[model samples]
Target chain A: MATIKDVAKLAGVSASTASRALHDSNMISEATKERVRKAMAELDYSPNYAAQNLVNRKTNTVGIVLPVRENQDSLGNNPFFMQIIQGISSICSENDYMVSLATGRSNEELQKNVQTLIRSGNIDKLIFLYSKKGDPIFDYVKQQKVSCVVVGQAYDALTDHIQYVDNNNFQAGYDAAVFLGQKGYHNIVYAYTDLEELVQAERYEGYQSYIKQQGLRDHHLGLSRVDNRANLEKLQSFLAKNPEIEAFIACDDIQAIRLQRLFKEADIANNRYALLGFNNSLITEIANPSLTSVDIFPQELGEEAANLLLKKILQESQTLIIPHQIIERESTASIK
Target chain B: MATIKDVAKLAGVSASTASRALHDSNMISEATKERVRKAMAELDYSPNYAAQNLVNRKTNTVGIVLPVRENQDSLGNNPFFMQIIQGISSICSENDYMVSLATGRSNEELQKNVQTLIRSGNIDKLIFLYSKKGDPIFDYVKQQKVSCVVVGQAYDALTDHIQYVDNNNFQAGYDAAVFLGQKGYHNIVYAYTDLEELVQAERYEGYQSYIKQQGLRDHHLGLSRVDNRANLEKLQSFLAKNPEIEAFIACDDIQAIRLQRLFKEADIANNRYALLGFNNSLITEIANPSLTSVDIFPQELGEEAANLLLKKILQESQTLIIPHQIIERESTASIK
Candidate 1:
């Protein structure tokens, strides 16, 4: 609530000198700078965002779009998105940038709301969450030329080349297959969500290559998602018909959790089958046998994505790729 | 991006009429309102919060002070908070309000924040998530005479005074006990979060009253939380100490999921040691032994709380104590 003038008066310095010291510009003496800072802190002075933004022509604020559903990712259940956002927020906060969340479930509605913010010239940059194929939002964002970075893989061709942060998903999939094969868990079933997603395609290829290398090729691949209970039930029916399936590789942790729950209902527990999942979500920790899944470092992802967006607004750089790691839990075990 | 004048010219109405229509004031004719709305839609006119707020002397926005880590309640895991927020947001968007989130973990900091917001006159009213025992946030709110509605329970001192929404905590605990008892499960274990909280205290009291009334004297209460993994380990130790415990009632779904994981590790599936959890969160659907828990109708809570806050802000009288219900899931019984 305190103004710059309040600090200046308290520090016995002119308002201009106080502001210069606060901005850390104009080469103020160390003693003067410290005095100004002490006065500012005592008076609870905060620099004005609105006024400062006009001179820089950038707000250092990143606008983020998420699904309106609170359970879109389940807050604690999947810390991937939340953690990424946290990372982005931390980076921005450190650089004095603010993050605002804008949400709508439908793509059309989401686009309109984002356009409102875009046209308002409120945010200098944007970080998008969706990676759905043929994303209309991405297309619109490209047209607007708002410095942008995507958390997911790029969906389509656009005016501006979008920088993104993603794991080496194909390599991860390939490695999962190799690990399962090394454990002597043959007759593996690679069940996943939409196979069209680039991440899924890479993982499936990895699974296939591993099977081909093992000379135990005639295995099954079940495709379904935990997000859709009906599709999961359908996938369960398919799995029931295929008795050759022993080990499983799920595209994501949520899918693995649902599959495990279904398997349990069919009287299958750990030791009967090995299960490996991705995203290393909270599901991995809570699921019976504690699922072993890949940790994509969501919080780091968010932080990186946010920083990338900030750099774009600052006219710095546009590209970055964070690393990924695997966490071992009870779900997958050496074939015993 | 279009102004009121642009909308007015397109709608063939005066600028004053357009403003009145946008504000939803009683002055505008129905035909005029329809025409202005059509123009606004065509022009992509997103309403201005600050300008309208200046004229109306109201922010229309209500602040929801949340704990820094909000994954505690079912609202954290379930899309419940999102659903509630969406419901409130729908009304706010239609009515033109900007919702701001503030952190409210420590009482001193919370008091400082509430005071700052009030002194700055940023928001129209406050909607508190949990009205714990004489929380400092409430104390400051009362001191400021700021309009507020407590989403959870209010103590006896503020019961007839402050507007609040109360969940049937006592009923939920009583029903849970009765349900377990009827299913031929006695010598139950009442596992709860720290009952220093009013809501928790009420729930515990309800459970105790039920046991006393039914003459079922073989139950013990224990403090078990999932905020940390060590507490979960402590819960495992508690279960080991009292091997005779047939069923455990968890206060929160996260706690139940943690309990479920511990049970799995200890090889105690639903058949032998049944567990009934509270706050029918998303954990129930995905947790290994889906939880049977209470539903506090979070969306309704948000709506009712927002409506009450608005009423108070407008100097309109409103009352509280909305109802709650129980939702049964697999954690309870697959009994004949």
Candidate 2:
């Protein structure tokens, strides 16, 4: 229950000096800060952050909003978000800032959660883990005029008004095809679900363009998100009719694994075809053949997004692109 | 900025009534609450939570502390924490609470991070994701008199003093061994790392007890956490020397997958032995022969922990045991 004044008196420093030392201000010498800290610790003086926030008009907390997904399992199963969160949390902790996670099972719930967070004035900045066209959460945050950063692509209309960090998904897709081609996979197919997400669309576009430029036949296979039986039949039929296809590039690692499982169920020999995936998640390394994946460096994406939002010069909209790499593994090793 | 008073005046209510409505107090009638909400929305009034928190002496935030590990990749690679966080976040969002993550790469760093979280007076409660004997973080939280719930087993000395939610790990191990025996496997070996964690020890104990009670020969393998080369060789030699062993029970899914990978490198046929793992993580399904694992239900553990901490009765120390299930898959199918 000791106050800053008491700590200052005990440390033989002025109250203002104690306060500055508590904030780790450059104006306060390390020796004085150490003395004040020792005195505070000795007196069991816990600083009231709520009161400090009121006075400074700062919360020293960042809000991380996860996207609302229809399949809630994605949130739990995907390690990409976890890695990004680790990156963000590490940086935030280093800077002495707390992280507040906002999540919900539905869009309305997510919006309400975010509204409550922003309205409560508990977070000074917001970071959206995913972005999409005409997202209500994005619109709401923008209307509230809260400083925020998006970790994925911003819509064309709002790109000028938002700061974002992303990988070049189109280029990532193109690079995947090029890598597979170099690995001697001539007839490569692109397989994805019906989610119609921005990243998938962009990547598919890149793949399509690469195929057309190479004068090769471009094959696309769409799988249902919910109906695994139909997907199995679809994959089986696709393989049956296209015996010449050498590889299939999935939109992400999860899809890649799903396809790999389907291939096994359909009695397809592992060496007959190659598989490539994105996001370079842990699953890629655990998959039977140890999948070849595009390492999107999700952690770096998170760190850069946090840095952009926390940067003092927040007036201008900034875009940061984290590079992606092709990690060759056993799944693609058969082709070589 | 619009104030509560302004919204109250616009809604034809007293400031106290408006405050109660904002907080959704049962004292305020539904009609009045709706009117106040409408007026506040019209006036674009955002409540100052810091001031409110100062008056209420509550931050409405829970701090989640992740265990410090020697390998940082474990934090990112493992999906257990992610699922647990999802469960915790779902319940927290429902009750209008924010989650703050405290992470560190080392014990000292974690202690400092946790100390800052507690001393900053920013969180009303703490949840430790893992429990260890003589953990400084746990000791610090205990000393600070902070309400906390541990998601893993508490040490013998602190069991009566602390609340915890954990699966009956000892029973889980016994059940795993029983499960393998029921699948017609006579010789089973328990494989684990050298970390000396409580859960592993308990599981191994159960396995050991089951083997003794059933009059079966017991086998045990200790793998290094860091040295994969040594582990690969050890596993190879163990398999070579013990051709009678029909199954290997891994402490968790990660180790199970590691063993599977090593078996492949050692040129062991997939059908030669059954692999059983705990945690039933995504990796179990993705592994080539799909590992059979014990579903410890990490998310449920998280939910139970949060419920215990947030329960109104804070005086009594309580322990909640989440049930575990054995999910049968391909890895064990060959033995059957």
Candidate 3:
């Protein structure tokens, strides 16, 4: 007889995700759930829902802990977190689970809200919509021994106990550089929103590693603030310094589109440079040449995070790595 | 010895919103709440919390009902609703109220979810993020006599009962046309996403009214679908058919950005056409010439909607018209 472990192995996911998928939990994505179902069918495995329900005693509600940024209004400014929330909502809707946002303007307020949510039995599991160093929330969750998942690259030192879902950003960055190279761009400028963001740093390292391997020249650019003034000045300086730069690999699509606009204003011919970005957002499609970008599939990441957290709640814990893809558009279609 | 109704009038909100604001309810925005408090103080009135609490029987939580669209993934695709959500979140956070989202892929599912949310006591009041005629959800809410507020213009028939918050889109559209005319663009194209959207229809009417009054030629264009193929084809046809068209008054910023891209690809010179849009989104900031657009103040609308809903919940209701502002940029700076 094929056991649940065999099915999990076939699906290539954590035993927890596989178990949640089999139970049609709201935390798993349709794609992951379909894969688990296919694996179960092949292995002839059937889960006992009645017995699992008796053991579960689940609240069917998940708490989303949004990050507290310096600006305090980051949620309204960045579409990244909103996209993740949509993804989480999709999966939760399917599984008949409710996702409530628990956020505050400051760390103290956020900690208080989280503690209250957990103590009051409002949420069965918690999903941190961000991963960063010195996040006090993580320590509190750990101390409380609460079931939780972080939706970004996990902290290296705490990887053993913390469950997380993240894209292989390093590989994604390396692949972006390789794509640019294949299009005959030798001098590449790496543009980033912030060096402190975990994904940006990882992607930047991967980009550096790729350029070094290919013996290509590197031009680093930073958009350290959302104010746009610093970013615009940096762009002008970079262009003045590196007139021979053939392509730009922005950390994300928003900045890439902004760069495209700046390039136009600075009288840089569109045909002279290829712009590649991450997070193939709507902005990419609306760009003049339609920007080429890496698709990190935030929806899938949200699904995986929710799934991992649910599994942890059920005493089935595991980390998951979501995959990414590169989308080719007119921005990188032709060499100058 | 002033009444709550007087405070509502002074605050330029409905009676329910005024009451909620005075009570420090979660459904009122900070701005409106402050205004209501000021109005109360000026009127030399102090509310009795015990009596109001007994009369209100408030749960202090509000439900946000998102529209079901033909494209079920509209929530992820459009930043419009996301902005409104952020606005609602800000106000709800200030008032110490929990905001819960109720959405479904179809009308039936949406109605069912709304009913369940209300019946189960997960939400105390409701706010609809979008409004159009013949929304079954509206009918259901009315039948159940559920307290609610719509974020856009209320339907003519339902105006008596339904409270709402909307911009003066008509005057805004007329102003946009007049602005383009001042820039020496006589032949103007009035563009829209879909005629069915309430805002689109109102803005289009405003555009028509402006052209007719000025005795200038008016060209009508529609992006019937967001798929881009039909939109691109329509753009090509519009350009070829009306070579005399000098300026475009797009219904919203997203469509305006898309039109700019389409024009660029179709071999239209950047300076040949004056482009103006509504809702000064980030896309406006990143456009080649930085798009000229109307600032609808979505955050304020969200705040107003929450305020109205709380008022409706407390049986103190009235319609509110939030104002709009025009922001000029390089896109319509001068005619070539």
DockQ top scorer: 2
Listed models, DockQ each: 0.26, 0.48, 0.15
Per-residue lDDT tens digits for candidate 1, residues B105-182, read 345545554554454344557777666665666776776656777766656443446776667788878888888887
Better of 1 and 2 by TM-score: 2
Ten residues in sequence with the least summed lDDT for candidate 1 chain B: B69-78
lDDT of 3 by residue, A171-273 (tens): 9989999999998888898988788877888898888999999998877888753455666777888888888888999988887888887777777777668
lDDT accuracy of residue A188 in candidate 2: 93
Query: Tens digits of per-residue lDDT for model 3 on B1-336?
Result: 467898889889999999878767998899999999899868755453223323454444577887875443456656667677766766776665666677776787777667655653345578888777778888778776467778887675344577777788888888888888888888999988788777887888888888999897768888854577777788888788888888899988878888888877777777778899998877787787788999888778888787666544443435577888889888997765
Please give the C-alpha DockQ score of model 3.
Answer: 0.15
- For model 1, chain A alone compared with the true chain A gives a TM-score of 0.82
Candidate number with the higher DockQ (1 or 3): 1
| Residue-level lDDT tens digits of model 1 in A7-97 | 9999999999998998898579989999999997798776654445445555545777764344433432443444555456456655655
RMSD of 2: 3.7
Q: How many pairs of residues collide in each model?
A: 8, 0, 3
